[model samples]
Target: MDSLKDVTLRPWPAPKKEELSQEDLLVKIEQLASERGHLRDITEKSLQEDIDAGKHIPDDTNDAVKQEAKEKEAPSRQERLEKVFNAGKEMYGHLEWAKFAATNALDLLSLVLSQDTNKRNLSTFSQTFREQGLNQGIPFGSFGISKENHEFHNRKPEELQRIQELEHKQKVVAQGARMEALDSAVDEILQAAKQLEKEVRRQTKYWQEIVAVSDQGWPLQRLRQNARHVPFGVRYGLPEAGDHFKARGFAPLQMDKDGSIILDPALALKPKTFRVRVSIDGKITGTSQLEVEVDTKDHSIQKSIQLARDSLFEEELYHEMSLETRQLLAYGVEFRDSVISVDAPLMGSTSHDRKLLIDCIPREDIVADSHHHEHDWLARNVAEALRLLLAHEHSMRLYRRSQSPPPLTARTQEQAPPPLLRTLLAVFRHLEGVDSLYVCLEMVANTLNSAGLEVTLDTTRETSWAILAESLKEPSKRGLSATDQLLEIFRKPFDGRATLTLPTSNGVQFESLTIVTRTIIGQPTFGTEHKLTLPSSLTSDLHLFQQLKFSSVKEVTSYLDWILPLHIAHRLLKSEYSSRATIKSHDSGITISSRECKRGSAFSTDIKVELLEGKLKATALTASPLSETEHTEQSHTWNGGHSSTSFKQVIQNWVG
Candidate 1:
């Protein structure tokens, strides 16, 4: 019995969610929503049910409950009641009974009435207003007059039927046109599906072939500026070039209609190789033919990549040497007509001059000489070394890049290319000098050994190459690779050494002599130099303390030719004579004197000993006081390589 204003409304309790993490808050909120039904789900029916259940009823718990109880007890006044007003007859009712009675009365009237039209003048039926219009156009209030014509407004039934027939024909034409448009749309969809399928097939084939190429270890990269037919590029050229070359090292792999990769212009080009011919005295002693292994079918992707790689290396090698030729012109290295000619003088032969004839020829052009030349190995080695050096140059390029870069500057400095020709020339000069010296020393050592003198000799072509193994075992602090270090030696001066047993230094003594040869292509000290360092014992014996320097192998051998025999005579022969030998000229001569007395006569023998050209020579004079006929002279020559030839045997007969 509460009035509307006096009935106090109770508000629902909200969930308490403070000091909770988002996860905990979400869990707490969901738990609360499930425990207590949502406010939005509370309906009047639920509220009335709660009210009927005696919830929210006033007890003396708080002021809110006391106020609620007071309002419920005091709300006996009627307020805001429904069904207090009645419906009016003007706007609220439709007189269905009256309308039915009127309709029946009208129908009864029509059954007896006659209809008439102005078209037929009169008819036996009640008049119908179906063909009549009450519209008077303008000046008739509250309605607009249409200026346009209407189909059935003022027209007869026959005219309306004719218009309907014409509309039906027009509808048929429009339907036909709509069907044609739908057919065109369907054809377009089919064509688009076929085109998409073809494109898919093309894409699949292209990527498959690209994957195959990738599996072969070729580097592939996406193009920065995409080409029309090319999306990716293959890098088959040398990686050490690092864009240093003016031409790029990669080429776009274009797709053809069949989804095969098209060979770029770089790959389509022919390959080349070096033809290093060893020419001696104007004759080809040896020739190298570098043949490429390729498939007969050009469709092979591997073949194309191989050709491109070979062409890149061969072209770069030739170009580098061509540029190097400018600086090596003084060293007899000339590049003319794509050919490099290097002067390689022989060891002992002064008449015939050897030359290394290098030509950058196409692989197809080298027709493998019909006959194998005597120095075929030499020519092939030269070519191989040249190629290896180029590869080494590529490695050096990478090494240089790995180092810290210089500060950026506006003043650009032009860098010279790798010294390929200079290295080749330096190696040639160094080897030539050292080999000649070794050959001479070997010949002398053999001759001395044949004379029953203990002598041996050994030499190396280059010291750096000799110790390359030891150098590679340890890591370099400077971050230089062993191969780079090895290749780097060729760019600088070359050093070679040979050790030989000094003359008369038997196996019991380890006294030896050393010869160091050095060569450079250019600068303060040009060409090859040979320096001789004799053993300390031999140096003191021969009054020679300083190292001997020679500009030519001929000069070195000539000097050795004179010094070896002098050491043998001054030290070996003089000591062999015991107390009987007198050293009057210890430099190169020895004298041995002997005297004997018998009962009837006196005998005396005097011998002069000398060594020349690594051989022993002795001359003896015999005389007796008994007669002039006793005066006799005998000479003995002891050359090497003969057991019967002995200086002792000849000197003994002269004394007896």
Candidate 2:
């Protein structure tokens, strides 16, 4: 390691002769003594830090090791301070009678160290005991005085004086060694202080230049002007300008006249305000008023807001207006002009079954004749009537067990829904064209009214099944007869049943025969009511069949029918004669060969043959067959040529 180098140190706050007199210098010295103590503390802390950081090696505390360390450590401010004190004390003892060395030394040290500019010079110190040794230098063991043999404590007054003089001289020489460097350091400190002050001022000027440019970062002038048109939001300058201007050594002022806020450097600013604008796609749907206020009371910030209300609900209004207009336009467009698909058979079947799809709109001509209404009313009804007609056709198919019709176009967008009045007119026109159609409809209408049905329009599917069922409840003056007949007569195509009962003089007789059963096969509902209305018919025919109450006791499935008078006579005579007459055994098997028996035959000879199964079979010999046999007998007599003399033979020929 190199030994301590000769380092040049400068004084801080260089001292002036006028500024610090001897008395002031003494006070400064005392403060420097305290500063020395502070520096010593700092040095110790640095030494400890070095030791802890492994920068110092503590092997042993020998005198040689201590000396080596002291030399390695460069002089600090505390050491320089102490040197000044020691030099001043030496001079003070020579001048003053009293011992003012301590006071003087303190004064000189303060003056010197305070003026020092060198940081290295401000960090020095000395051992406390060594300086005391310099105050009293001669060794105590120098006189021949031993602790075991004390001789009047040895005369040492002159020896003490000699010791003090030598010590004082040594102290003086030590203080004089650094005197020239101290003087040079004072001048150096003064020069450096001037330069530092200049640097601080230059930096301040540089910052101010940078802040001036940054203050208008967002064009506050434009922001203020634009804010006037917005109706909302306050405009203010940037909040950071004050801090920035201060850093640059300039005071910034608020630009309140332009509505641009600026933080004042002179006064504490609570907070700054600024303007903002919100827009979408450049369309001005709304304008708002907004205020940003910073309360100086508690530095609280709040924004007040107000927005213009939209008075026109345009979206909903437009949609409603368009829908209504479109509906009206649709009325002019021709609809139902297209047949789509027609199933006449299905419609006919519905008539036969006496069921109409009341929900469906009737054909156009029929609708017009029925109502004679305005076109608009007719249009609405027509749509409904058509739907009902289609539905009736479909229901009839189900009733007759027929194959479903081909799919018709359900969506007729071009057609405005035909009105109810139109359908009624169309139906009336249709009825007028076909007599049978009128009769069918009248009967149905009558039957429906009589059945107490309640008619109501169904709007769901444009077709109404409701009217049919409901209309049936209306009263029918002719009862259900006309409807019953019409439904059955037209039902030939649908295979329906019919029953007829007629009154005889003796009894009431009836017959049920189905001309066509094909139609009713799938139409179970329509045929259900066809069940012999014998009860209803009989009830109506009470006066006509009142005499049948006394007829034969035999139970008859059809009470409406009884045997005729002629038929009854034939039945009685055959029964009586069969019991009394002889049983003529025929050539073949019990054949009645006598012709006299059949003369104006009031009775029928019914020969009943009973098989083993007890099932009786009957054959009747007619009066004409008996007469023919008699004629054959006469012809044989004539052929024999002896019949002229035989009276019996002649009689036989005449009888034949």
Top model by TM-score, which number?
1
Every model: Cα RMSD to truth: 22.7, 35.9
Candidate 1 residue-wise lDDT, 382-414, digit = tens: 777888888888887777788989999999978
User: What is candidate 1's CA lDDT for residue 284?
Assistant: 83
Write down the TM-score of every candidate: 0.66, 0.19
- Residues 332-355, candidate 2: write the lDDT tens digits: 211232211111111323333111
Spell out the clash pairs found in candidate 1.
1-75, 2-75, 114-125, 114-126, 115-125, 115-126, 115-127
- The C-alpha local distance difference test score for the whole of candidate 2 amounts to 0.31
How far in Å is the alpha carbon of 177 misplaced in model 1?
A: 2.6
TM-score of 2: 0.19
Q: Number of clashes in model 1? A: 7
